[model samples]
Target: MPVEMKVLMNHIYEYQKGVRRMVLFTFNQKYEPAVVDRMRRLQLPFLLQPVGNGCLNLYFGRRECLDAVRMIVDKPLSRLTPEEDFILGAMLGYDLCAQCERYCERKCRRGHCGAAGA
Candidate 1:
Protein backbone atom coordinates (compact mmCIF):
# COMPACT_ATOMS: atom_id res chain seq x y z
CA MET A 1 0.00 0.00 0.00
CA PRO A 2 1.05 3.52 -0.71
CA VAL A 3 1.88 5.61 2.31
CA GLU A 4 0.40 9.09 2.23
CA MET A 5 3.07 11.40 3.51
CA LYS A 6 0.83 14.45 3.35
CA VAL A 7 -1.87 12.76 5.38
CA LEU A 8 0.75 11.60 7.82
CA MET A 9 1.99 15.13 8.27
CA ASN A 10 -1.53 16.29 8.89
CA HIS A 11 -2.02 13.54 11.44
CA ILE A 12 1.10 14.62 13.22
CA TYR A 13 -0.02 18.20 13.22
CA GLU A 14 -3.42 17.31 14.57
CA TYR A 15 -1.95 15.04 17.20
CA GLN A 16 0.41 17.74 18.38
CA LYS A 17 -2.44 20.14 18.80
CA GLY A 18 -4.12 17.96 21.42
CA VAL A 19 -1.38 16.06 23.18
CA ARG A 20 1.62 16.87 25.31
CA ARG A 21 3.29 13.54 24.80
CA MET A 22 3.35 10.81 22.19
CA VAL A 23 4.93 7.41 21.78
CA LEU A 24 6.71 6.21 18.68
CA PHE A 25 7.42 2.65 17.72
CA THR A 26 10.12 1.68 15.28
CA PHE A 27 11.58 -1.50 13.93
CA ASN A 28 14.92 0.00 13.09
CA GLN A 29 17.35 0.76 15.86
CA LYS A 30 19.23 3.00 13.53
CA TYR A 31 16.25 5.31 13.29
CA GLU A 32 16.08 5.92 17.04
CA PRO A 33 18.29 8.97 17.28
CA ALA A 34 16.97 10.66 14.20
CA VAL A 35 13.35 9.93 15.04
CA VAL A 36 13.73 11.22 18.56
CA ASP A 37 15.44 14.35 17.33
CA ARG A 38 12.67 14.98 14.85
CA MET A 39 10.00 14.51 17.48
CA ARG A 40 11.76 16.90 19.79
CA ARG A 41 12.02 19.43 17.02
CA LEU A 42 8.32 19.12 16.44
CA GLN A 43 7.86 20.12 20.08
CA LEU A 44 5.77 17.07 20.80
CA PRO A 45 6.52 15.43 24.11
CA PHE A 46 7.13 11.77 23.46
CA LEU A 47 8.37 8.63 25.13
CA LEU A 48 10.26 5.99 23.22
CA GLN A 49 9.05 2.56 24.22
CA PRO A 50 11.08 -0.06 22.46
CA VAL A 51 9.79 -3.57 21.96
CA GLY A 52 11.57 -6.66 20.77
CA ASN A 53 12.01 -7.29 17.02
CA GLY A 54 12.13 -3.64 16.10
CA CYS A 55 8.61 -2.77 17.25
CA LEU A 56 8.28 0.66 18.75
CA ASN A 57 5.19 2.07 20.46
CA LEU A 58 4.51 5.78 20.40
CA TYR A 59 2.30 6.80 23.28
CA PHE A 60 0.23 9.94 22.95
CA GLY A 61 -1.11 11.97 25.83
CA ARG A 62 -4.61 12.12 24.38
CA ARG A 63 -6.93 9.98 22.32
CA GLU A 64 -7.24 12.74 19.72
CA CYS A 65 -3.60 12.32 18.93
CA LEU A 66 -4.20 8.75 17.87
CA ASP A 67 -7.22 9.72 15.79
CA ALA A 68 -5.01 11.94 13.74
CA VAL A 69 -2.45 9.19 13.48
CA ARG A 70 -5.03 6.73 12.24
CA MET A 71 -6.14 9.10 9.53
CA ILE A 72 -2.69 9.20 8.08
CA VAL A 73 -1.42 5.66 8.59
CA ASP A 74 -3.29 3.17 6.41
CA LYS A 75 -3.46 0.50 9.06
CA PRO A 76 -6.70 -1.10 10.20
CA LEU A 77 -7.76 -0.47 13.78
CA SER A 78 -9.49 -3.84 14.15
CA ARG A 79 -6.38 -5.92 13.67
CA LEU A 80 -4.63 -4.78 16.79
CA THR A 81 -4.70 -7.07 19.83
CA PRO A 82 -7.60 -6.30 22.12
CA GLU A 83 -5.45 -4.74 24.79
CA GLU A 84 -3.60 -2.61 22.32
CA ASP A 85 -6.79 -1.61 20.55
CA PHE A 86 -8.40 -0.49 23.78
CA ILE A 87 -5.42 1.51 24.89
CA LEU A 88 -5.19 3.17 21.54
CA GLY A 89 -8.86 3.99 21.46
CA ALA A 90 -8.96 5.22 25.02
CA MET A 91 -5.78 7.22 24.84
CA LEU A 92 -5.47 8.12 21.19
CA GLY A 93 -9.14 8.25 20.15
CA TYR A 94 -8.44 5.93 17.25
CA ASP A 95 -7.06 2.53 16.37
CA LEU A 96 -4.11 1.84 14.09
CA CYS A 97 -4.68 -1.77 13.16
CA ALA A 98 -8.25 -1.71 11.89
CA GLN A 99 -7.48 -2.18 8.22
CA CYS A 100 -4.00 -3.49 8.66
CA GLU A 101 -3.17 -6.38 6.40
CA ARG A 102 -2.50 -9.57 8.22
CA TYR A 103 1.04 -10.84 8.09
CA CYS A 104 0.69 -14.09 6.21
CA GLU A 105 3.30 -16.29 4.65
CA ARG A 106 2.72 -14.90 1.19
CA LYS A 107 1.69 -11.36 2.04
CA CYS A 108 3.82 -10.47 4.98
CA ARG A 109 5.20 -7.02 4.49
CA ARG A 110 7.77 -7.57 7.20
CA GLY A 111 9.18 -10.62 5.50
CA HIS A 112 8.88 -12.82 8.55
CA CYS A 113 9.22 -16.55 8.01
CA GLY A 114 5.61 -17.16 8.99
CA ALA A 115 4.49 -14.83 6.25
CA ALA A 116 6.83 -16.21 3.62
CA GLY A 117 4.09 -18.21 1.97
CA ALA A 118 1.06 -16.24 2.99
Candidate 2:
Protein backbone atom coordinates (compact mmCIF):
# COMPACT_ATOMS: atom_id res chain seq x y z
CA MET A 1 0.00 0.00 0.00
CA PRO A 2 1.19 3.51 -0.75
CA VAL A 3 1.84 5.59 2.34
CA GLU A 4 -0.08 8.82 2.53
CA MET A 5 1.98 12.01 2.33
CA LYS A 6 0.25 13.50 5.36
CA VAL A 7 1.01 10.43 7.44
CA LEU A 8 4.60 10.39 6.28
CA MET A 9 4.99 14.06 7.12
CA ASN A 10 3.47 13.47 10.54
CA HIS A 11 5.98 10.73 11.24
CA ILE A 12 8.77 12.97 10.01
CA TYR A 13 7.58 15.73 12.30
CA GLU A 14 7.58 13.34 15.25
CA TYR A 15 11.08 12.17 14.44
CA GLN A 16 12.31 15.71 14.14
CA LYS A 17 10.79 16.50 17.52
CA GLY A 18 12.56 13.52 19.13
CA VAL A 19 9.27 11.76 19.79
CA ARG A 20 10.79 8.57 18.48
CA ARG A 21 14.28 7.27 17.83
CA MET A 22 13.10 5.39 14.78
CA VAL A 23 10.12 5.16 12.48
CA LEU A 24 9.00 2.56 9.94
CA PHE A 25 7.27 3.78 6.82
CA THR A 26 5.93 1.36 4.25
CA PHE A 27 5.09 2.43 0.72
CA ASN A 28 5.04 1.23 -2.85
CA GLN A 29 8.46 0.44 -4.30
CA LYS A 30 7.87 2.88 -7.17
CA TYR A 31 8.22 5.81 -4.78
CA GLU A 32 11.58 4.69 -3.47
CA PRO A 33 13.62 7.28 -5.32
CA ALA A 34 11.51 10.20 -4.18
CA VAL A 35 11.53 8.95 -0.59
CA VAL A 36 15.27 8.49 -0.70
CA ASP A 37 15.69 12.00 -2.03
CA ARG A 38 13.61 13.40 0.81
CA MET A 39 15.53 11.46 3.43
CA ARG A 40 18.83 12.60 1.98
CA ARG A 41 17.66 16.20 1.85
CA LEU A 42 16.60 15.94 5.49
CA GLN A 43 19.96 14.40 6.40
CA LEU A 44 18.29 11.37 8.01
CA PRO A 45 19.95 7.97 8.15
CA PHE A 46 17.75 5.23 6.72
CA LEU A 47 17.67 1.65 5.56
CA LEU A 48 15.34 0.67 2.76
CA GLN A 49 14.34 -2.98 2.88
CA PRO A 50 12.16 -4.64 0.29
CA VAL A 51 9.10 -6.33 1.78
CA GLY A 52 8.15 -8.13 -1.42
CA ASN A 53 5.09 -7.60 -3.64
CA GLY A 54 6.37 -4.25 -4.87
CA CYS A 55 6.55 -2.68 -1.43
CA LEU A 56 9.38 -1.37 0.71
CA ASN A 57 9.86 -0.61 4.34
CA LEU A 58 11.75 2.56 5.18
CA TYR A 59 13.49 2.38 8.53
CA PHE A 60 14.74 5.87 9.37
CA GLY A 61 16.40 7.19 12.48
CA ARG A 62 19.65 7.14 14.37
CA ARG A 63 22.42 5.15 12.71
CA GLU A 64 22.76 3.04 15.83
CA CYS A 65 19.10 2.09 15.82
CA LEU A 66 19.28 1.04 12.18
CA ASP A 67 22.34 -1.04 12.98
CA ALA A 68 20.43 -2.85 15.70
CA VAL A 69 17.58 -3.49 13.29
CA ARG A 70 20.01 -4.81 10.71
CA MET A 71 21.16 -7.41 13.21
CA ILE A 72 17.67 -8.52 14.29
CA VAL A 73 15.87 -8.49 10.97
CA ASP A 74 17.67 -10.65 8.47
CA LYS A 75 14.33 -12.16 7.36
CA PRO A 76 10.87 -10.84 6.64
CA LEU A 77 8.99 -9.14 9.45
CA SER A 78 6.50 -12.01 9.67
CA ARG A 79 9.36 -14.45 10.10
CA LEU A 80 10.94 -12.80 13.11
CA THR A 81 11.27 -14.98 16.19
CA PRO A 82 9.11 -13.96 19.12
CA GLU A 83 12.00 -12.36 20.96
CA GLU A 84 13.10 -10.56 17.86
CA ASP A 85 9.55 -9.34 17.28
CA PHE A 86 9.43 -8.01 20.83
CA ILE A 87 12.73 -6.23 20.42
CA LEU A 88 11.62 -4.64 17.18
CA GLY A 89 8.35 -3.54 18.71
CA ALA A 90 10.14 -2.06 21.73
CA MET A 91 12.61 -0.21 19.54
CA LEU A 92 9.70 1.24 17.60
CA GLY A 93 8.19 2.56 20.86
CA TYR A 94 5.33 0.09 21.14
CA ASP A 95 3.68 -0.34 24.51
CA LEU A 96 5.80 -2.64 26.65
CA CYS A 97 2.87 -4.56 28.12
CA ALA A 98 1.38 -5.19 24.72
CA GLN A 99 4.70 -6.37 23.36
CA CYS A 100 5.03 -8.72 26.29
CA GLU A 101 1.57 -10.11 25.65
CA ARG A 102 2.38 -10.58 21.98
CA TYR A 103 5.67 -12.22 22.83
CA CYS A 104 4.05 -14.57 25.28
CA GLU A 105 1.30 -15.43 22.84
CA ARG A 106 3.77 -16.26 20.11
CA LYS A 107 5.83 -18.34 22.44
CA CYS A 108 2.83 -20.19 23.76
CA ARG A 109 1.75 -21.02 20.27
CA ARG A 110 5.08 -22.75 19.84
CA GLY A 111 4.45 -24.87 22.99
CA HIS A 112 6.38 -22.69 25.36
CA CYS A 113 3.44 -21.99 27.59
CA GLY A 114 5.55 -21.40 30.66
CA ALA A 115 6.05 -17.84 29.51
CA ALA A 116 2.43 -17.04 28.96
CA GLY A 117 0.61 -15.28 31.79
CA ALA A 118 -2.69 -16.92 30.83
Candidate 3:
Protein backbone atom coordinates (compact mmCIF):
# COMPACT_ATOMS: atom_id res chain seq x y z
CA MET A 1 0.00 0.00 0.00
CA PRO A 2 1.08 3.58 -0.47
CA VAL A 3 2.15 5.61 2.52
CA GLU A 4 -0.40 7.53 4.55
CA MET A 5 -1.49 10.84 3.10
CA LYS A 6 -0.17 12.57 6.20
CA VAL A 7 3.31 11.26 5.53
CA LEU A 8 3.18 12.43 1.94
CA MET A 9 1.81 15.78 3.13
CA ASN A 10 4.71 16.21 5.53
CA HIS A 11 7.14 15.84 2.63
CA ILE A 12 5.09 18.26 0.59
CA TYR A 13 5.11 20.71 3.47
CA GLU A 14 8.88 20.57 3.64
CA TYR A 15 9.10 21.23 -0.08
CA GLN A 16 6.72 24.17 0.16
CA LYS A 17 8.75 25.56 3.04
CA GLY A 18 11.93 25.49 0.90
CA VAL A 19 13.50 23.08 3.37
CA ARG A 20 14.02 20.46 0.69
CA ARG A 21 14.97 20.73 -2.94
CA MET A 22 13.86 17.19 -3.70
CA VAL A 23 12.03 14.35 -2.01
CA LEU A 24 11.43 10.71 -2.87
CA PHE A 25 8.76 8.23 -1.86
CA THR A 26 8.18 4.61 -2.71
CA PHE A 27 4.63 3.59 -3.47
CA ASN A 28 2.78 0.75 -5.07
CA GLN A 29 2.36 1.12 -8.82
CA LYS A 30 -1.39 1.08 -8.33
CA TYR A 31 -1.16 4.46 -6.65
CA GLU A 32 0.59 6.17 -9.55
CA PRO A 33 -2.50 7.59 -11.18
CA ALA A 34 -3.85 9.06 -7.97
CA VAL A 35 -0.46 10.41 -6.98
CA VAL A 36 0.02 11.91 -10.42
CA ASP A 37 -3.39 13.52 -10.24
CA ARG A 38 -2.64 15.09 -6.90
CA MET A 39 0.69 16.44 -8.10
CA ARG A 40 -0.98 17.89 -11.16
CA ARG A 41 -3.64 19.56 -9.05
CA LEU A 42 -0.86 21.03 -6.94
CA GLN A 43 1.23 21.88 -10.02
CA LEU A 44 4.22 20.14 -8.52
CA PRO A 45 7.02 18.93 -10.77
CA PHE A 46 7.83 15.25 -10.43
CA LEU A 47 9.28 12.09 -11.91
CA LEU A 48 8.03 8.55 -11.48
CA GLN A 49 10.04 5.43 -12.20
CA PRO A 50 8.97 1.84 -11.95
CA VAL A 51 11.14 -0.18 -9.57
CA GLY A 52 9.91 -3.68 -10.17
CA ASN A 53 7.66 -5.78 -7.94
CA GLY A 54 4.72 -3.43 -8.40
CA CYS A 55 6.61 -0.56 -6.76
CA LEU A 56 7.49 2.89 -7.97
CA ASN A 57 9.83 5.60 -6.88
CA LEU A 58 8.21 9.02 -6.94
CA TYR A 59 10.51 12.02 -6.97
CA PHE A 60 9.15 15.51 -6.62
CA GLY A 61 10.62 18.95 -6.17
CA ARG A 62 12.15 21.78 -8.21
CA ARG A 63 11.85 21.33 -11.95
CA GLU A 64 15.51 21.89 -12.62
CA CYS A 65 16.49 19.39 -10.00
CA LEU A 66 14.14 16.85 -11.52
CA ASP A 67 15.54 17.57 -14.95
CA ALA A 68 19.07 17.14 -13.74
CA VAL A 69 18.12 13.85 -12.18
CA ARG A 70 16.57 12.68 -15.41
CA MET A 71 19.71 13.61 -17.29
CA ILE A 72 22.16 12.14 -14.82
CA VAL A 73 20.50 8.93 -13.86
CA ASP A 74 19.44 6.42 -16.47
CA LYS A 75 19.64 3.30 -14.34
CA PRO A 76 17.90 2.09 -11.23
CA LEU A 77 18.50 4.20 -8.12
CA SER A 78 20.26 1.26 -6.53
CA ARG A 79 22.69 1.21 -9.44
CA LEU A 80 23.59 4.88 -9.51
CA THR A 81 27.22 5.82 -10.09
CA PRO A 82 28.96 7.41 -7.13
CA GLU A 83 28.78 10.88 -8.62
CA GLU A 84 25.16 10.39 -9.48
CA ASP A 85 24.52 9.18 -5.95
CA PHE A 86 26.34 12.20 -4.56
CA ILE A 87 24.34 14.58 -6.69
CA LEU A 88 21.07 12.99 -5.68
CA GLY A 89 21.95 13.04 -2.01
CA ALA A 90 23.03 16.67 -2.16
CA MET A 91 19.86 17.70 -3.95
CA LEU A 92 17.77 15.82 -1.39
CA GLY A 93 19.28 17.87 1.48
CA TYR A 94 21.13 14.94 2.96
CA ASP A 95 24.05 15.80 5.25
CA LEU A 96 26.97 16.98 3.12
CA CYS A 97 29.55 15.25 5.24
CA ALA A 98 27.75 11.97 5.09
CA GLN A 99 27.26 12.23 1.36
CA CYS A 100 30.91 13.03 0.90
CA GLU A 101 31.93 10.10 3.04
CA ARG A 102 29.61 7.84 1.13
CA TYR A 103 30.94 9.06 -2.21
CA CYS A 104 34.55 8.55 -1.15
CA GLU A 105 33.77 5.10 0.12
CA ARG A 106 32.04 4.15 -3.08
CA LYS A 107 34.89 5.47 -5.20
CA CYS A 108 37.44 3.64 -3.06
CA ARG A 109 35.49 0.47 -3.33
CA ARG A 110 35.46 0.82 -7.10
CA GLY A 111 39.26 1.29 -7.06
CA HIS A 112 38.91 4.77 -8.43
CA CYS A 113 40.18 6.65 -5.42
CA GLY A 114 43.60 8.25 -5.60
CA ALA A 115 46.36 6.91 -3.41
CA ALA A 116 46.49 8.40 0.06
CA GLY A 117 49.04 11.21 0.63
CA ALA A 118 49.71 11.36 -3.09
lDDT of 2 at 41: 96
lDDT of 1 by residue, 1-118 (tens): 1243343355577666754244444335556665566667776655555555765555444446656555544344435544444454445433445423322322343344452364
Question: What value of lDDT does candidate 2 attain over all alpha carbons?
Answer: 0.91
Which candidate leads in lDDT?
2
Indicate the worst ten consecutive residues by lDDT in candidate 2.
1-10
Per-prediction TM-score to the true structure, in the order listed? 0.42, 0.92, 0.90
TM-score of 3: 0.90
Number of the top-ranking candidate, with TM-score as the measure? 2
In model 2, which runs have C-alpha deviations exceeding 4 angstroms? 1-3, 115-118
Question: What TM-score does candidate 1 reach?
Answer: 0.42
lDDT of 3: 0.88
Model 1, which residues run further than 4 Å from truth? 1-10, 17-27, 62-85, 95-118
lDDT comparison, 2 vs 3, better candidate: 2
What lDDT does candidate 1 reach at residue 76? 44
Q: After superposition, how far is residue 48 of candidate 1 from its true place, in Å?
A: 1.0
- Flag the better candidate by TM-score, 1 or 3: 3
Task: Evaluate residue 4 in candidate 3 and report its C-alpha lDDT on the 0 to 100 scale.
Answer: 56
